[model samples]
Target: MNDLLDRLRGILLDTGYTIDGVRERLGAVAAAALSREETVPALRATAGDDPLGLLIRLWWLGAPVPARAAPVGLPVAELAAAGLVAVEDDLVTAAVHLQPWESGGYVVSDRKVRPGDPALRPDHVVGAGGASANLAQLASRRPVGRALDLGTGCGVQVLHLAGRAAEITATDVNPRALELARIGWALSGIEGIDAREGSLFEPVEGERFDLIVSNPPFVISPAGRFTYRESGFSADGFCRDLVRLAPRHLSSGGTCHLLANWLHVRGEDWRDRVGGWLTGTGCDGWVVQRDVQDPAQYVELWLRDAAEQGTPRYRGLYDEWLGWFEAEGVTGVGFGWITLHDSGSLDPVVRVEEYGGQVELPVGEYVDEVLGAVAVAHRMSDAALLASRPVLAAGVLEERIGPPGAEDPARIVLRQTRGLRRSVRVGTVEAALAGVCDGDYPLGPLLDAIAELTGEDPSDLRERAPQALRPLIAEGFFHISTG
Candidate 1:
């Protein structure tokens, strides 16, 4: 089996069937179209005598290929025997979807059971998608002793954890997903992963990991509809329980990273709701709510995600799911990443805020940096924070704006050119402080210097400087010399 996989990989590489190769072959327009789940452009681009093209069309795009036309170096018979491909009549069709996923090499998962089909099978397996991709980007790549991927569908996270973690464990409730993930690990040549079958935290009971990552079945459903997504749990209960239980499963300084959806109930603040879950969890949290949708919009969005919006049973299913939300008194659903750090500090802080917009991925290092900033701010007294030397982050840029014909700028904006792409408008003191933060001096002395120059009261300057700087440190705009 290993030899067969090696040969298969050799064939894929030699024929230029990798991600970059495919993207180069199909231009940006076709690639974008494929990302939207439209296969027409990809089909048109890959239709040729090109070996890689044919294989891509057959294996990835779900187009059937003549049996005799199987690419060279791929053992068609062996793959068929392995149940990866099915031969019917004179044509061969792939039983699984194989794509060039990142993390050392490609990953495999079940293809859509039937494209354009309204209803999904209960055992359907979710693949490497936007959610998983975002979660990977959000995961820190720091080396760890033990790592766990909860609900590891198709082994995408397991494949990612291969080199970074000394020991890796992957779990899932669906046995078929585990089976597919085992096959994926084998094909990708990733080993040492202890794949187990269970729901969130059940299989790994009493064992703590240095890092835990989950892009779990987080979709809020009417009931458990698809095995890949629905948890059969109550509204967002899986997410809530996962967050609440993470602290118990984390070693000191460990982290539990998750992608989730939380309900915004009537007469309740969203931040308070999310913050309430973190209470007694013994972990400092950084929650970034990327988006929010009303009940109807949430139902419609997920219905479309499941590819059921335009089908014959769309109305009935939509009504049923919407009814569930209505009965639950959910006003909106919030989608985002929850980053937890188990620093074991008694006074743990939970930063709950919404950061909406496009930011760079795998901001894992940035995420870690934010946690460090939080810890530093927590440990330092007001005087110590003001006494620390500060430098502007590398990506920060300043923008001054004013109404037309004005000699002086009316407002100043400090924006990050990379990593989170954060931007904020600042007042005179902050703008002045930003211009001089070259790491040459401590913030306290800097503010004193500014007061000397501006004739403001030093007491007032000292009082407000740390408050303005604290957020910048936490958000990565300012890098302080912690050592």
Candidate 2:
């Protein structure tokens, strides 16, 4: 199997069957259409007999191609024997979805179940999609001694962790997902991954890792019909349990990145509800709710996800899902990323907030810096913070909005142009403080000078400035200079 996968990898790479290659062949219109799950335009674009074109049609569009069109050295018979493809008569079709990921590797999973297709199998393994990309971007890229990809469906995250982690362990509850993941890893030429089969944290019992990442089956659904997206546990219990159990398996200073959805019940603050998961975990946690949807919206989205819409059971399933939400007192569902850093501090900092802003790509690059800043600001005393010199982060711009020719601006806002892209409204004193925070001088003297210029008492300014600046530091707008 390994030899066959090696040959398959060579054929794919040599034929330019990659994400970029496919996009270029499909062109702009066809590529965009395919993203919407409309494959006619793509099919039309790839009607030629080119090797890349034929491969795109067979694997990506899930369309059969003439067996004669198979490229030389493509081992069609061997692929058929391995169940990677099915050859009937003069046509060959892919049995699994072999996706060309951006990381220069292929992911093997169950073929996509489109609308009007049969209902999904009980143990269907899903291909890498938006959720997988989100968790990948959220995961820190620092080299680690050991890393774990929990619920490693199709092994996409393992591909991302290939070089960064010295040793990798991937675990999943479904044996089918594990099997496909192994196939994907072999095809990608990634090795030495300890693939274990068990439900969440059970396979690697009592072991710790330098990093753990998961895009778990976090959909809050009444029926656990799909193993890839629905945990049998009730009402976001899987995500909650995953969070609470993370710290136990995290080595000191280890970090865990997860994409999850949590319930928004009546008479409960969603912040506290989600934040409660991090309590007593002894980890500095940051939970950001990127999007929220009402019960009806959530139900419809998942229903459409399984391609169940327009089916006879669609309305009944939708009604059943909504009824479950109502019975569970769920008003809405909050979807977002959760990052936990094991700081080994008794006084751990946990922040839960909603942020809908444009952020730069590969947030993993600076996540540690952001979390470190937050921890420092959280623990620092006013006097200590004042004595320290801080610098404004790059890409921060000051915007003053007001009526034309007004003496003073109506509002002053500081906006980050990169990574998180957070914006905050500020006062004159804070604005003045931001202008001079270049790490050349201590914050105390700078606040004193701003106080004098703004006609406010230096004592009062000093008293209020630390609280104001702490948030800026926490959100990556201001970098507390350790130098």
Candidate 3:
């Protein structure tokens, strides 16, 4: 089996059969079509006896191939041994969708059935998909003594975590997923990732980790349709429960990164509802809501996600989900990342805001910087904050917008070219204040200088300066210099 695995790895590398390779082989049009779950374009593109085409068909397209094939072929017997493929009458079909997924490096997991697949089982394991990649990119790559990957479906997170965490523990509720994860780790020749089968924190009850991460079963569905998604918990219960318990399992100064969904009730404020979960957890949580959809839109999105859209069962599932949401007074659903820090503060700081900006990949470092800024503000007083020297982040840029023939600028916007790609509009005073944050002068004196120049009272300007700078400071527009 090891020899077969070695040969398989060689075949993939020798042929350059990676995600980028497949994209290059098929071109942008066909690769993009496949990304939208429309496989016909990809099928037309890969119709040939070429090694790359044969391999694409065997793995992604699920097309039956002759038992004997050349450099394009996978090791049939070994794949069967690993429960990845099944052969009958000299034709091989993929029992599981095996694809070469690349993140920080090579990560392989059984693919989930998409819109193009003819048949699918409830237990189908998902590969390194968008959600997985999102969480991985959002994960802090800082070296740590130990990490926990909660709900490690097919072990994609485990594979990514292995590179950073010294010791890793992976937990899941589904037994089949655990089985496949073990196979994946063994095939990849990666060890020391302890896989356990239990729900949520039950697997690691008495443990404390330096970092805790999860791409959990947070679909917010009414029933347990798929083990990878549903957890038989009420709407958003799985995610809420996980966030509530994460602080207990994290060591002081540790951080927990999670991808989650929270429902928006009709009359209740979503912030208080989601923020309430972290109450008494003794940890600071910063929740960034990336996308929000109404009840109807949310239902349709997940239905298509499961490739059930336009199927005979689509209507029933849609009705079931929509009806449940309507009955429960759910107006919308928000999806995004929740970052928690184990500060053990009694009055934990919670920042819940919507960020619809373009996201740069490997956002963990950026998040860490923002969190650090927020932490500083949490402890510093308004007077102390106004008295601190400051500077703009390295990626910040400013633009003056007005008519081409105009004298003075009408509006000034500060934009971040990296990280979250956030853009903020500032008034004249705020803009001038941002320009002088050179770390040589404190904001209190700067505001007083501006007030004297503009004929405004320095006392009033001092009060307003810190209040105005608070949001910008917390958002990384201005960094308070400790030196």
Candidate 4:
């Protein structure tokens, strides 16, 4: 079984087809099979309106050939138990399909999302969605004793975490979601996952984990849907509660990775707003505001989602979303990754880094790098304490600006040359550090020299030096001494 899984992973990776791509193609195969079935009307009557589930069943009937050589003698029950398919009320359903044996898992069809039969559950398992994949890849893949996946939609994150953690527990508000997760788990042949039906931590209460990952019901609702996507709770606060609850559920040295949204209030700093969420929790948190949207932008994105769900009146739905934002004093909304590490520090490191410009890397990879960077940053001390101190090249500058229509400058700007395109506001000490950092002496001596030169406190200079060096090291404007 391990050999088969390894071969499958190797083939998939070599073929350049991602797990999501293969799952999507499999869904497409199922959809195409159902569309061509002769007894579609009969199945529709039995299945209600879940086109996705209907397709899954149709694929299972041997009509839609998932692969050319269909692994003859493989039991359908085994596949279901493995989480590849679902059999409900005598209907066959497949969460994913494969067309041919490529180097890796490959699907040659356009995947589809089908709802389930009305009697079964409202929020049926989706094959795999972008949000789930993003959150899964963004999470830390290092070894852990136990991990918890909240709102484990279709069990994608659970399946991924199973490889890294000794044990994994997944939870969702809907029972059907657990069923779907089970199907995905079985089909993928992933192990060590336990699925439960409950909202958030209800199922895992008093059970602490080394890592917690969630996509949650982050889709801000106009009016809540009864199924998987909605929390029946309001925006911002809904995710806030989930995060706040995580600290208690986390073991010492544990980490919680969340994909969340927070409303940006007018005249309020987004960092301070998110920073407030991390206070008194005995956790070090890093929040990145990946993207920001105005009211119209926010409305349009979720409006498309409702329309996809066959909701009527697109304009009305848009209006409702706008009304929700207005009533909540939300001028703008920011979406990003939030990581909380349970380090047991009284004053833990809580930093907010914004990725404002275009990201050349994929979102999942970018988020993964962010987590890796966080882990690396945790191991290192203050920049001044780093043994591998950076030797910056000469083009960095401190530019001061003049007040509008005034002869004197308004403020000092710390600017870097080459790589990362980073800049900062230069305080008096930072400006002094920049001027003196010629890479000859250690930071302590430089601070002493500067204190004597400017009649300032040497302790203050020592404390402020690391702040200036951080951007330099991160931006590659300063290269560290490996020696």
Candidate 5:
């Protein structure tokens, strides 16, 4: 099988059939095979002697999958050919293509179950999924000496770490997953990863890393049928355990990055629930809940994961999931990213940032900047004070939120009657301008100008400037111009 896999991988590379192309073509072949016996030959030809594709075709022949069933034994070379992936180098590869699909709620990677198809095997090693890729790309790209990818699925995050860090280790509890991760590593040409087999930190205990990362098995399941995606705990115990244990394996100044889900238990704040995981760890942590889904939506999404459509199994699974949520008093589920830093601080900063609204900027870069802000906030004495020095000149407009239930509703508009028509939220005179500014003047001068224009007291304006600038500064609408 290995030899066959190797040969098929070579052919796929030479032929330039992308992973997506393979999936689409394979799915097309499989669909045809189920509907008509003549299509089996073409499907087999697509696999050629590739064990993974062969496995996928066998199942598709038996029953038409929902197109969401995971693909089995995907060839890396094929994925590269698909333009969905890029070969980073002789060492360290990445999946740069998952972002666009991820935004649309699809995991466009070699490692996904065929879209809308369910007969494919669950453990099939495909390209890195969207969530895994998202966490990896958003991981700090700064230089680090050592890094660990916890729950290294297909070694996607490990691949992202190869060049950024001097040494890398990718760990997983599933041996099959470890092998697949190795295969991905080999395909990516990344080396030096100690592919250890263990759940979370067990394999890397006593060995600390400058960076520890994971996109763990966080889907709370009644029965953990899928080892790679689903967690053992019915109440998201896997994530809690990972959070609690991650601090122990970090080096001083080390950072742990991950994407996870937590149940929003009734009568319990999500922030407090996650904060509990960081307790006793002494690590500064930032947990952002990107969105919350009701139990019904959660069940439907997971059911769609296996391509189970209108099946009694789905109903039973939904009941079980709801039962688990109900029994635990969970009203919703919070999904987001967690970042922990073991930088050795007397008072670790723990913040739960919420981002449920629509965002205009590219989210990955925004996530990176926020992380950088966290790092800066830790080091700086007064962020507001530092921001006042040499600000840029950016025009900001104040758009009114609709007037409260008035007969004639007000227009929500950005009225930028000055410099650049940049829509930024700036409160008051100086602070509003300063918040929307591109760092053109001194904080003192900006406040002075605002006081002069708005008839506010200068001292009072100066005092209020920082508060107004906080929101604008957080958003990149106000950038510090180094020129």
Candidate 6:
């Protein structure tokens, strides 16, 4: 199988069946339509009988083609024997979905489940989607000795980790998912992944990793109808447990990045509820809620995910799910990313917030920078912080907003134009501080100078400045100079 996969990879690259090649062939219009799962535009776009076009029509579009018209290097008979494709009546069709990922590799999973199609298998291996990309972007890019990809469906995360981590372990509860993940790893030319079949941290018991990344089965469902998305545990329990267990499996200074969904109860604060999961973990944690949905909307979304909307049990299942939510006191569900760094501090800095603004792509480096800044902020005393020189982060803009012809501005805002795009309201003192923070002078002296210019007491300014600047430093608005 490994030899066959090696040959297949060569043929795929030689035939120009890569991510860029496919995108150029499909064009923007067809590509956008294909994202919405509409195949007509793509089918029309790939009507040519060329090798690339044939591969696209066969694997990507999931359409049957005449066996004689199969691409020259594609091993139809071997693929059929390997259960990757089916041959019947002089026609060939993909038995699985093979997609060219942006990392210049392929991922194989069960065929896309469209509405009105047959029900999904209980152990269906889902393809890489938005959640997979989110976790990948959130992971730190720093080199590490070993990495763990928990619940690695189709092994997409391992492909991204191959360049940095020396050794990788991919684990999944479903055997089929592990099988497909191995196939994906082999085809991507990635080797030596310790593929294990177990739930959560069981496979790696007593072992630690320098980095861990997971896109777990975090759907808050009443029943575990499908293994790919449903954990079979109670509402949000799986995600919470994963967060609590992750720190123990992480070596000192290691980081864990995960995508999760947590319930928003009617009478409880969602921030406190989710933040409590990191308590006593000895890790600096950051949780960002990107989006939220009410109970009804959440139920409908997952129902459609399995293509169960057209089934006879759809209405009954929907009602049952909503009822379970009501009984469990879930008012809504919040989906987001959870990042934990094992800082081994007695007082770990844990931040939970909602961020719906635009952010820069490929945020792995930014995440590492943020964690380093927060660690510094948490460790430094007021005197140490004031003695340190700090500079404003690049692309930070100061905006003063007021009505026309107004003498004084009503609000002053400092906004980041890069990763996270965070904005904070500020007073005149902080605004002046931001304008002069060039890492040339210590903050204490700078504050004294500002007080001298603003007719305030230097002693008073020094007393209150550290409290105001700590958050800015932690959020990456300011970078403290080591020298």
> Which of the predicted structures, 4 or 5, would earn the higher lDDT when compared with the native?
4
TM-scores of the candidates are 0.95, 0.98, 0.94, 0.65, 0.70, 0.98
Residue lDDT tens for model 5, 366-468? 4545544454444433434544453433344446555687663244333333321235433445335645455555566666776787788988766765555
Question: Residues 1-483, candidate 3, lDDT per residue (tens digit)?
Answer: 657766776787677677788777788898788787778888888887778887788777778777776354567877877677888888887775556667523444456567655545676667768899899889887888989999998788877778788999999998888877776666566787888999999999989999999999889888988888878899999999999999889998899999999999989999898889878778888998889999999888878877886688889989988999999999999999999998766667888888878888789867778787787767778879887898877788889999999988999999988877888999877888777778999888888888888899999988877777878888888889756
Error of 3 at 279 (Å): 1.7
Off by over 4 Å in 5: 1-8, 19-127, 279-281, 310-312, 343-345, 357-368, 374-387, 390-424, 430-432, 435-440, 475-483
How large is the C-alpha RMSD of every model relative to the true structure?
Answer: 1.9, 1.0, 2.2, 9.1, 9.3, 1.2
lDDT at 257, model 1? 95
Ranking by lDDT: 2, 6, 1, 3, 4, 5
Scored by lDDT, model 5 comes in at: 0.61
Task: Quote model 2's TM-score.
Answer: 0.98
> Candidate 1 — which residues are off by over 4 angstroms?
113-115, 404-408
Per-residue lDDT tens digits of candidate 4, residues 158-205? Answer: 666766789888898877667655644544556667888888789998
Q: What lDDT tens digits, residue by residue, belong to model 6 across residues 207-276?
A: 9999999999999888998889999998899999999999989999899999999999989999999999
Q: List candidate 4 stretches off by more than 4 Å.
A: 1-121, 308-311, 358-441, 446-467, 470-483
The alpha-carbon lDDT assigned to residue 423 of candidate 1 equals 96
The TM-score obtained by model 3 is 0.94
Clash numbers, per candidate: 1, 0, 0, 25, 34, 0
Whole-model alpha-carbon lDDT for candidate 1 = 0.85
Q: Which pairs, if any, clash in model 3?
A: none
